[model samples]
Target: MSTFLSALAGGALIGTSAALLLILNGRIAGISGITAGAVMPLSRDTPWRWAFLAGLLLGPVLYRLAFGAWPVVQLDAPWSLVVLGGLLVGYGTRLGGGCTSGHGVCGLARLSPRSIAAVATFMAAAAGTVFLVRHGGW
Candidate 1:
């Protein structure tokens, strides 16, 4: 149906972007890694990192303008909780050595054991959290 077609198109777009970023930039399109590099860039690698980060920041705005609608994700949690969750994600990224895109997309495609483990752990934790919050026990 229309929804399935839309989802397929969206996924294909994501995969294309990921592939292009990896092949052209020789970098994984991991938001956390990109943000970190931009914020705490080394002496020689700041401009391109900043530009990449800016592209990421502006991408959704451009998408909304072109599509006339933005994806909606509503959370019941307060702003403080959301901020706390972000901090936790950043911390976990450092602990795991990479974010989801870096590990799941680029790394797993390259057959890295660390990336495989990281992605698996991420899936298990995410599934458990959703179960606890939605159905199991919260």
Candidate 2:
């Protein structure tokens, strides 16, 4: 019951943000695009994006301070690995023309064929990577 409630709350928050972004900006709240814009912003067009990204970056810090611990289990992976993974994900998002939220939620909801294919490919790649890491060890 607690877990379900927590998940429901999280989902509601995500849906609300998505709806708000669509309504306010006619844009999907896709992190990749948001981060890119912040890094290489359009002239005089950056505050909202920066604020959004800042919230995302600061949310966990606030959570840690508020709760004394994050809800999820922690991983001991190297910081370099995590940074590399983020970079790779950013690159992949560009290659795929959007990130998971854009393609998986917004695009699929809109019945986009390209998003369907892109998401399928992303899933397959993720599965394959996990398999290789866990079993193949190659």
Among all candidates shown, the one with the greatest TM-score = 1
Per-residue lDDT over 11-118 for candidate 2, one digit per residue giving the tens place of the 0 to 100 score: 777778888989998888877778888899767778989999878888778879977987586777689878987888988998888878888777787889999998
Q: Rate the local accuracy (lDDT) of all candidates.
A: 0.81, 0.83
Candidate 1 residue lDDT tens string, 33-132: 8777778875676677788777777877987998888867678997987998899899899778788778876788789998998999999998998798
Candidate 1 has a TM-score of: 0.83
Worst 10 residues of 1 by lDDT: 40-49
Off by over 4 Å in 2: 1-5, 61-68, 78-84
Poorest lDDT segment (10 consecutive residues) of candidate 2: 69-78
Report the C-alpha displacement of residue 24, candidate 2, in angstroms: 1.8
Query: To one decimal, what is the Cα RMSD in angstroms of model 2 from the true structure?
Result: 2.6
